[model samples]
Target: MRYLRFTNWLTEIDRMSGPISAIWFEEVRRHAGTDAAHVYGGLMATLTAWAELRGVPCEGVPVGTIKRHATGKGNAPKHAMIEAARARGFDPVDDNEADAIALLLWAIETKGGLA
Candidate 1:
């Protein structure tokens, strides 16, 4: 899928903000050899590159935004999201991936992708 590479790039994307405004884990910085600021910055850079290649606009909401929208709590557990996914009629084998997709669906709904 077109998003496969994008997802990989996201992992390597440098953080653009420090821990203060950063919503992701600090280990993302440590493993990426950059601060949260640089990682987020790199993420934007990668998005720009991908958009140029695809000739389409692609904007991503913050993970926290997705999480809060999906479960009513920003720090909801993976299993909770998986349960939500099941309720929505999608069977996800992996809880974390399920949660992420659930968050994606939540964002889509908020953006009027759903009726």
Candidate 2:
């Protein structure tokens, strides 16, 4: 159901603009004991597979890379990351939303797209 909604959302975007040239995600792993990490990892895997099946160009950036891009430190703490987003004039709701915005900016810059 989530995938369906996401695909539908993508379709809507395509209708509004054009085909999305690519998709980007921050690569993450559960490592050992975190439940949210495991769930998000699984969801990302599913989304990646679906995107591949649909022939959408899907790419992932490591968490460290995103951190470095945003804050000059690959091991930035969540509070630091939030601060970095604020520095960019974004009033993020939380670290996760701030990270997503940063990731989106990274994708645009990396893909040579207008931001």
Candidate 3:
């Protein structure tokens, strides 16, 4: 359902602009149960469907990985991610959304593509 909403949003965004490089799923696990494998698989499917629909690129990365890469520690605190976000050249007001976007960009850079 969330994935579907995201795809819809992406499609709407695409309609306004041109195809983009990727999509970001922030704290995606929070939206799932204890089933990690199922969550990841569902993520892949959602991304694939979104990519196919928009003819754009897409990828998914865990929120913690983003915090780790952005903040240094895999289990860094939120304040740490906030500090790191500022240090990384983003304004403080942009922390949450920017962190999410950064996480998505990191995933896209890491993965080849949605396919």
Candidate 4:
């Protein structure tokens, strides 16, 4: 049920955003608990499979890389990431949104928007 909901959400996002040029996700290496790790693995697998089936380029940006890019530190805290996103003119509602914004910026700068 969770996977179904996630895939449905992904489909809605893709529909609203038009043809996806690429897909980028944070590569989380560590988790506080086994359950979290398992969930992350499942989500990652689902996302990669979805992207593969659609022929959309997919890449996982390391957590440290995103933190460093956003806060000049490899292990920046959630608040620091949020500040960084705000500094980029984004009003992220939470750490996850802030990280997403940072990831988008990094992808655009590094891949030239995957052009």
Report the number of clashing residue pairs per model.
12, 0, 0, 0
Query: Which of the two, 1 or 4, has more lDDT?
Result: 4
Off by over 4 Å in 1: 1-44, 112-115
Ranking by TM-score: 4, 2, 3, 1
Best by TM-score: 4
- Superposition-based RMSD of candidate 4 using all C-alpha atoms, in angstroms: 2.0
Pick out the ten consecutive residues of candidate 4 with the lowest summed lDDT.
Answer: 106-115
* Model 2 per-residue lDDT at 95: 96
What CA RMSD would you report for each candidate?
10.3, 3.6, 4.9, 2.0
- lDDT score of model 3? 0.66
Q: Across residues 36-85, which tens digit of lDDT does each residue of candidate 4 receive?
A: 99898889888888889999888888999888889999999999999999
Query: Candidate 1: lDDT over CA atoms?
Result: 0.56
Q: Write the residue-wise lDDT of candidate 2 on 49-88 in tens digits.
A: 7677778877778899889888999999999989999999
Q: Model 2: residues >4 Å from true position, as ranges?
A: 1-18, 31-38, 112-115
Give the per-residue lDDT of model 1 (tens digit) for 1-115: 3345765554445333311211221112223445656756666666666555645445555555555666777666878777777877888998877766765676457652334
Candidate 1 or 3, higher lDDT? 3
